[model samples]
Target: MDGLNRLPGFEILPPEAPMPMPAQDLSAAPRQVRRGTSSPPLMWLRRLLVIGGALLLTGVATAEMSLVLGLSRWSATGVVLTAIFALLSIWIALAFTSAVAGLPGLLRRSDPLRLGEQSPLPQTRTALLMPVYNEDVGQWSARLSAIRASLRAAGVVDGVDIFVLSDSTDAACRQMESDAVLALRARDGARVFYRHRSRNTGRKAGNIEEWVRRFGGSYAQFLILDADSLMEGRTILALIGGMERHADVGLIQTLPLLQGGRTLLARMQQFAGQVYGPLIAQGLAWWSGAEGNYWGHNAMIRTRAFAEAAGLPRLPGRKPFGGEILSHDFVEAALMRRAGWAIHMAPLLPGSYEQGPPSLPDLAVRDRRWCQGNLQHSAVIGAAGLHPMSRLHMLVGIAAYLSAPLWLGFLVLGLAVSFQAHFLRPEYFPATHALFPTWPIVDSERAIWVFGGTFLVLLAPKILALVAVALSTRRAFGGRMRLMVSGLVEILLSSLLSPVTMLTQARQCVDVLLGRDGGWTAQRREGEEIRLRDAFRIARGHLFLGLALTALAVAINPLLAAWMAPVLVGLVAAPWLIAWTASEEAGDRFRRWGLFLVPTEEAPSGVLLTSDTPGAGDDRAALVAAAMAG
Candidate 1:
């Protein structure tokens, strides 16, 4: 009874292997170190192409918008609207161009490092570090067991060990977690270890650093896994093999597919990720090359490199903008790159999987937390010695959240412009000797062209992703017709949900600006049903905003109202939409009709099959009884 509420017979943790992880100084000069993998000329060219293309697209779109708004007689409101539109347009343009650039890689399914089944496993010891925080014990245990089984089957389990790092504070939950691990250890012995920290301290990053300081010396590399992460053993071996083969490489990230989606929202995410994720990831990999980013989980990291280079320092100040870094992965990658260690992405790697948020509300919670983390990156973007690409990575992360507010401002300004058009009388013959009156006119025809073009750009990535799938793996998604239908469903749902998401993220940005902390909260993985009251509670703001927009649009003009119908409808129907999508029944109904059919669901791997079964690893009742008996 070590005061941790540790279950009897599972009181001891594995012996510690001390390793130093010192805090990094942002102002320190760059380290002069050994030569690492150099970024190819083509990588630089790819970056130039994507960046230049986005800028060109944004410039052209902004010029068109300016013309539509009567550029020569541009009002203050018109200028502001144009600025916001330009800001918003760049992100979408970048995405469109990036997808286009990545299409070839996606089509070819390129494996740049030549990693395959023939790759040899490393002899060095590795650890699988799964950090849990008030998560479902049974589910995670089962997943870990399946992973263990997977590794054993691959003949690499002998060199790797599994560590269940618990930040769970609940005594009962800790007991259950301990009980589950006890059962696992009973079967597997010292290969499995469970350690609990009384204080969460710096949250997940801290939990990991603590582990590094305590036990990192025992392992040459460690793979980070989210509570929901599940990897096939071969994928794990391949990542290790990559690290071993490329000694200069510090980290390697995999594009984990969203699997086990049982809610409508989750299914949509899965479908979209399966269809669209490849192009985006490939594009990233193509441009990023050796200077790639880490996505926190389903990734492998060189233990020494991380310990030596990725030590994070707390920023000066309080709450949201300062203190502990929230988005640690990006900063870690940047630091490692600064230390001249190559970071790479293996987008073509398969068998890396993760779960998605079960509902929109759940997504909002996660996004809010991430919003704070990304916004905090503003302080670190200017840190000395960071690679140019690393700086761009942080900047893009901040821009991702900022784009929501920019969109809101754009919409609001457009509404104001419309109101001005309907209410204010145009100055006819303002100049005493004017040849013709400037009618405060908006070029409706030109505006249509601009709108259509913007819409097309926004839709380009999805279309490209669909085309890539159709060309390569149509049968994987229930054939071409079903895939198309699923794509349509995903697009429609995403469009309908966009406005709500925008408002939510806009509010999150505002909250962060107001110095509110999102704090560490447990994510709801299981797709629990959303009741009407809860749905209404969650969506009241959206509902109110929707109604306000609808009224304002109608008052301004019938055409304006028609133009805003989709946004207004989504806003007004937020409650029903959230509830309906969160329903397991709705998800099942979609499944029955072959909608949102991802390959993982159609054809599960052996590990997934094992996870679905009631094994001793996660048989909670049996574990509980066994622990009590012990």
Candidate 2:
């Protein structure tokens, strides 16, 4: 039972030592964490006083300006719109902040994640769902192989049912599914199975429904997995244990660290998520508690609860607002919560991991489908029977896609305001106010606040995430040096790719609104890159927006033009960023900067390798062999 016990659905690996790390000095792994006492009551009191005072001053000043400037006539409308904006902003801030704050609590409560634990799953059985469409079989197999090996090492490899739910309309993918299932087997009669439906009807949700309808009776719980995800067996066990401990919970979702991404863009995303994701996730989990929703993957759900709560509802018609819910996860989560079942997210499930999209275009293609789904959910927000938080989720889902249009509106409004102030001014010009008055940019002097606030919103999360990673894990991922260089590179790449990405996302939002689709596409393999030509073609999405911004900046001031150059250059070179981002060669070259997930052989000096389990470090060797043989 200690060394190699069976876990449901996982094949066993023979005992062999873990792969050895190159011998090197290892003094830096953090042995202690700073669990400082909560802020002094007086300190909090002072902060509250300062914050409240500022709010009071802001409200009074706004009133004074409106009254003296005779702008009070617009106050009623402004107040309503301002309240909406404030509420939306607060929701976002809470979702992210709560996710971050829950970490210390998580760190305090759970055992440090390690390898090799027996599942002791009791009598409960679990179904492992790997929902696949046109995804790369090799990539999916590799992740599952690692997960299975981890489970095998922990002992409890026999209590799980693994289903490869193929929604492949393509004949080749169907064959690929058959081949993959056949290749992954134990002496047990095909513990791994594949089923494809002729109707690939409602996309992912429909795919899941088919499984539930046919196989729901077999397992008490099911863990849904994205094709490109991996979870440590220990994490899986912890989730099952957590679920068993909490009877009213319908689902528990884990945020996986992004893995196997080769592009600079992908690494940045992965690093950002790893560094700050926990805090944001923790913050969300703390506030959300039992209202968290399923993300459709890397999550476990109670079968009966889901069946009762999340039956796919038909939309009124076809196209953007109809048929199946593209974003079924949030809606499903809301449904579970509305049904009075707790929907939770495990903020400390470290073994869980996923892959990031390698190229901008690829990500845009995926998001287009998501946009349609979310927009559709916008309507579901009004369903009278839904829980408040569930309705909030649908609202947020709609807002996320709509942000592009909002940003675009801000740009247009800024331009109109500028022209009015410069060419058609009619009073109202001390050239300074904290908030804009819908008039044209008064002398263009308020640029700093606008630029500064925008900058903070975009970059503060990265900084916060970085701080969280350093505070919590410190030397866990080797040393400060190993983590530092990796973080820096991730940030730089992310800044460069973001503008281009936003443009692509903007197009996707537009496309979804227009009722057109990019169609169902397959995910790429672990290391594949978009061709340079494709990258360039894709860059065209942002070029116009970028060039227009540049022209506007120049028209305003040469200084402004200079400041905005990166955005323009980025748009013009969108294809280059996409190509470089999607390229493994580029990723490998950057990895030398001590900035990312180095290939296994080229890991930097002084990296500390730990035994996954308490008893031994042998399972990794077995894992390598089994993975290769397959």
Candidate 3:
């Protein structure tokens, strides 16, 4: 189809070059990924340290908890609660140790690929595949234009093919996309193609696979991007160079930082990602080494390797956990590893970017789909010939969602035991006619200590992130004072949001388990002002929950209520918090005060800045109307 074909029936895709993608079997063994002899010992040591530290921490916490509850007088309920605490503590301990393990790498600023400022252009041809659904065409097209401009500036535009692979079902959206593509081609005078599928089978995974089948043979590597993703020209080159240098590597995933946040929640997310994201990613990369998992976007992959190893088979069964894999990235990495291909993460590489959900309600909407996808990993975790690390990756993905409900259970069970202790008659008189009936009580001081320690365990990583930033990257975050203030604001906001997120995720888990499918829904990238009625409607359940917990705790004892204040407050203020944080004005107010300041906000990249800037002869009203129509 030509660029002038503005009709709804036409598409602008390239010529076909079919590549076979055979379905992989989960039960059978495939060739294992071969690595250098030096890697195993280091990999084993890192794994051992993380695993061993978690075990050690859990064991010590269990003993302390046991002591606090008085093991000699332990009720069945107390024992069960203690076991649950131990399970919860393991996740915390693992994170804490991983942060510690990764701190050195961040401080040193290690670059594994050695992609310096004057890096030479990559020799291999690459395809930049952006698969869109019902997205705002104006914003999407602008970002694409910015990317093409950045690439052209870097003198690598000749080696790259930009393809807009659309699964957009809306006719208006399709027409707008076609028009936008034509505009981009006319304006940039660059090679850009567009393809639209009438049937979005398998959703995004299917969109990509269709591209691979039709046009995969022409490109040596393909960089997969989401609708919201943008990368600097240099970062794109660095990724291509990294792939070229490592022939055995199947994929190299960049650390895509959050950008373009305008709401309070979005800025908070931006801050957390800016401050804490690197430490977490560094730790993951250190241990994961060549076995890193894909996040599905902003990552480049070898066309042949992906075609040979990452083709997905529909999980046999019904919905939710069955049929098409909702989270295809992790499974694809596993399948690639099973076929002897390495997957690596370049955590230190910068300039890769994406947008975050602008409100808590929007986040919940997005997370429901993720929760379903991660839960589906339970079926793929046992697949044969997968690397142990790959399996661990899937297990971690499953636990990430499951942990929320587990935490809720812990809270409820603890509350239940508290109720039983306060309401039930003491059984101390049965043993002997004691002068004073033994009270059903724990060591209050020890219990306080245990609680304090658990809180510290939960908060330490954030504190460590602050310390790391202060010592190294403070200037990037608008100097030390700004960084510290931003860190504090982030911690405060995150604490308030945690209970609400926990409850939301717990509900999502229940929905997924109960055979509810979180069908593929388009993400709302640019947020609107959240109305009070809308916020309250979404958060009424959380509000009711908060009130219920508050009354129950107060009835038990004021100190118990005080102990649960943070969580109770979060629940009670859910609606107001949602509405307030969804305000762009509130986010702007914080930005003025230099609170929640991220590097991207202080000094934006050229491509990112260009995305927001209007081009010459542009019709602003028309673009806004088109975007609103989507």
lDDT, candidate 3, 390-494, per-residue tens:
998999889899999988998887777766666775442234443222335666557767778988988888898889989985487878998888888788888
Answer with 1 or 2, whichever has the higher TM-score.
Answer: 1
TM-scores of the candidates in the order shown: 0.94, 0.77, 0.93
How good is model 2 by TM-score? 0.77
Candidate 1: tens digits of C-alpha lDDT, residues 1-630: 112234363344666789999988999846746655544457768889999999999999999988888853366887888888888899999988988999998888887776664667677889999999999887888888889889878887488888888899888788777777767655554377788888888899999999999999999999999989999999999988888877888998999999999999999899999889989999988888888999899999999999999999999999898999999999999999999899889888999999999999899999999999999999999999999999989989999999998988887777767666657755423445333223367665677788889999999999999988998865888899999999998889888899989999999999999999988899999899999899999999999988988888777755557777778899999999999999999999999999999999899998888877534345667766664454
Q: lDDT score, residue 370, model 1?
A: 91
Q: How do the residues 266-326 of candidate 2 rate in per-residue lDDT, one tens digit apiece?
A: 7666666766676667655554555566677888888877776677676667766776667
**In candidate 1, how many Å is residue 410 off?**
0.8
Worst lDDT window (10 residues) for model 3?
Answer: 1-10
Which residue pairs overlap in candidate 3's backbone?
Answer: none
Q: In angstroms, how far off is 149's CA in candidate 3?
A: 1.1
Per-residue error for 203 in candidate 3, Å, reads 0.5
Candidate 1 residue spans exceeding 4 A from truth: 1-12, 38-41, 71-73, 425-439, 614-630
Q: What's the best-to-worst order under lDDT?
A: 1, 3, 2
